[model samples]
Target: MSEVQFACSTEETHQVGKPQAPSFTGPFTTEGGLTAITLSSPSEMDQWIGEWIELAQQTEFCNAFYEPTFFQAAVKNLASQEDWQVVLIKEDAEDKLIGFFPFVRGRGPARLSELSLWKSKLSFLTSPLIRSGSEQQVFKLLLKHLRTMQPRVDLVELPMTLAEGRVHQELHRLIRDNLLTTYHYDHYSRAILTEGHDYDELLTENIGRHHFREYRRQLRRMNNLGQVEFRTNEDPEYGECWADWFLELELKSWKGEGGSALKQDPQQEEFFRELVTSRTRAGGVEMLGMFLDGEPVAMLCTLVSQKGCFEYKIAFDQEYKKYSPGMLVQLHKMQRFLESKRSPWVDSCAVPNHPMINRLWSERRSIEHMVVSLGRPWANIVLGAMPLLRSLKRTFRKPKR
Candidate 1:
């Protein structure tokens, strides 16, 4: 095999007005008699990434779940705080960009070289930018790169969209077949708005059944307390106050409970703070507070984009739990969305099956996982053993329906 060297100068490679041009030039012949190439800069990979997303839209699992700008923003934010690297892969002769993976350096209590540098923030869902016909091939190519790059990473954590079945399943199969070390975390959930074929029709369908009756019931019940109202400030100037109040409610809700919000990690807090400010500027942040007797009892912070409204955060006074203030706040938010006709869907975000989400939204969303490793003998042995370990662990537990 012939070897070539490519320089790693960012400014020289990422010149203005040529976003699609390759930064570095190299070549490799694959076992399938295919050639592989690499691009060095994120901007250079944009054209192919855009094409992949367009093709991804036609796939069955496609949803407005991931916006390119959101990913870009997240990448920028994560990169700012940590040592990270972005890898772009392409098929050799075809000149088609196949995948992009943004990874960070591994740090923390876990042993170094035992895991891949993973993202601390939960924003980017790992979906490959692959053409329909080349999904498996593209994934295999990415695995080859990851394996070659593994010494720099430890464990790899790629969260797949549950709706995208093939990639995740293929990844699992590959891990077992190759014998790689793996762990699975079933965290996060989403609520999908369903009811109509179109946005307006969906809202119409939700009116009496979802929004009206429930919201009216809550209002009537709270009316005896004095007054119940939902409020929002669209002006950007009000964002800081909104964030402060929302954070207070969130922290209070988890005051005694051992939950994520109670951890009070500065990094996560900074991420949220930046997220609120940035999204607000883009008109993507919607802060909704519910007032009972003219006092705030519950609040929700939703992210609004062209795709839909995401229920990112919600909290209600524990004292008001008897009245189901959280549920009441959600209903009002949904009703407000319906009234404004601003967005087509409202995602409950990723959470396990909760009663509120299951009862309110008719549509279901999924979370996916992917494992990519270098096809090394040792890696294969470890990865291949995971299924057996899982089976053995399951055998010791009580059976469930």
Candidate 2:
């Protein structure tokens, strides 16, 4: 575990990562005087850290994954290749950064060369970093550049992004205006906790009386096991310790036997540690744990951006499964979200129709996968057929009933 050298502060400063001089020279500048620079390494982002941090602060749509602190850890530890491209869009008039997009030319559906948005295993959001007031201009310039690239990017796919966010709305607007060609698929809703709902009333309304009684019964059983307590770690000095505990606790569960825990992969462990250490002082990351007699039985890792929270990951010791320690911790977390002065809403970041979260959080957030034609008619034709292809695939892939 790495010790974070910082003090807790309500406000975060852009003084992250060591400074490095701009290594790439002669970036491609669009005719509209917007400079688009693509770097092959996340470390190259050091030169524009200030602008990138500022853009994250003023982004039109909030994506905790796109934030510099999270991006650095994800790219450095999780990226599979050096070919990943970090595209930064800057306006020439005022020399201000308007957008940040990470891309990679990879094999997409049909094994076609696709300029796909780069996202790691745990990143659930793909909304690009676009300056708040400059979304329109940024999108226009970005799409135009993508359309006219030298090698000719015929396909660009955003694997995961908010379905109804401002960025998605702009994509729709551009498509309706005949400025772009695109295809959307895999649209689904995930569980979310929304504001203004009393947690007790929500439970009374959503959970069946008998089911709620059983849950309470399980909680009472756990209380009988030992001194049960729910606690959260926000102190910078203990962030690394909390992260370590989370990893160990997760490994004591089925995830470990299945080789799916963070400790199962060294790189994944490193990423989690660095992310916690980096964001500890800024208060962008937190760990909530359910402890029995001072031993953790369940844990949750969360990412905070602006006022909203993303429940990024959760794990529980299987030894405590009978008492449902995982769900119990979530119950406490849900209560905290509702009663805390912070934002009332939280994105579970769980898979669609997740058994546990869907039952607990009645609200939903729409997300989708989108592909752009990038001004290629042939690609547009293929893109148009994707939904049908997907439908057929699903029909054939379903298990025989």
Candidate 3:
């Protein structure tokens, strides 16, 4: 860790008797010349929205979860209830904003003395927003900045990072260059629909002739009950009401029965609502629904940006589960996605080996949880023993046979 002071002007500095500044500090530049600043509150993010959105628009890796609007909604409705920090990295020469990393320091006894990228259960990807060409430099500065913070942390965990993406590739380079010790866990790939693939080819290759025929057979069965249709809604006028419709329809699914639906929690419900409204107003939301004679039986929410689109959430009316309304709606999304030239791809954001999405989309994006030592002696010791600790844990967890 480098020794860097908290440099500030006389007026900006806290006095013995006067009140302190609003937890904002630093253009803390490292010897490598990248500067970092930490924002203590989400409201402070308002000042950097322009730069933040621009960074998202130009990032080499697309993570809709970290885009400006969705990120703000997450902070306000989900993460605000906890302690967090947002670190901004910039080029020292031109003072251009290049990286955005929001994280929560571990808390409570057995705190683990670590910092984790901030994300709620509702979020999927965990890649930070970094300018397209500056990933390596930005990552170096981010780690250095983190190392200089008070009550020093031992480990840094980046959850759900897109494996082999530019950011991930850069992290590998940094690990070698910095001589950093690192560990990876929960590595798996989820379905994705890349642009330029013919929809017919993609569908046939993934679902197979037997399943493809079965899909048509199921649609025919649905048509027998009512006029079946799949509709994509993008107009802002219906954002709120349609979001409500999605929530209600989701509540009719197994998730609701198991108490895991977004509508099951007040805060999570508000988060989705705000996310829909904000993204809709920015022309960044699209809702897809499978309707039975004009009544929606399945719905999916997609959040869009210049980089790409994310399949954020989905729900289906349990009454229509046998007919596979959920799968049908996904097929519709894939077809529509291929037809549009707006974004390069749509990430399913589904869990690894997801039964439905994996069968529909053959393309996969690997995600992983990575832990790296912060170069502290204690951090090094913990990381060195991690593998053995994990082995012991698994051994103890084994069932007596």
lDDT per residue (tens digit) for residues 1-401 in model 1: 33244443234545488454334543332435343444333444465555545544443333322334445545545445544445555554544455445555554112334333234355534554444455566566655655454244445656554544675566566667766655454535556773234433454464545664655676687778877777886788777677777666777675425456622656556656766776677677788898877678898887775545667778877877767788778777765776677666677775667767666666766664534335444544555666677789889988787
Q: Give candidate 1's whole-model lDDT.
A: 0.57
Q: What is the C-alpha lDDT profile of model 3 across 1-401, one tens digit per residue?
A: 45455645334454588633223354364647677877666677776676677778788877788888887888777875655667788765555578888877784113557877888878988888888889888887787777877667778888888887788889889989989988776788888888898877777787788888898899999999989888766578778888898999999999999999989999999999998988888889998899898889999899887778889888999998899888888887888888987889889888777888878878887889888887877677777787888899998996989
RMSD of each: 6.5, 7.4, 4.8
Report the number of clashing residue pairs per model.
26, 0, 0
Error of 3 at 66 (Å): 1.1
Ranking by lDDT: 3, 2, 1
Select the stronger candidate by TM-score from 2 and 3: 3
Off by over 4 Å in 3: 1-27, 30-33, 107-112
lDDT for position 214 in model 2: 85
Best by TM-score: 3
Least accurate 10 contiguous residues by lDDT in model 3: 19-28
lDDT measured at residue 156 in model 3 versus the true structure, 0 to 100:
84
Q: Candidate 3, clashing residue pairs?
A: none
lDDT tens readout by residue for model 2, 1-401: 11112222212332456343233443354647776665666777877788788788786557889888898889888987656666778876666678898888776666656888888987998888888766677777777666545455678888898887677787777777765567876789999897788877898788877777888899899989989888888578898899899999999999998999999999999999999888887889878999999999999889987657899989999988888888988888888888874864689999987999898888898999888776566676787788889889988996989
TM-score to true structure, per model? 0.66, 0.88, 0.90
Off by over 4 Å in 1: 1-5, 8-83, 89-99, 105-117, 121-141, 150-156, 165-190, 195-215, 255-263, 338-344, 370-373, 396-401
Q: Which ten residues in a row have the lowest lDDT in candidate 2?
A: 1-10
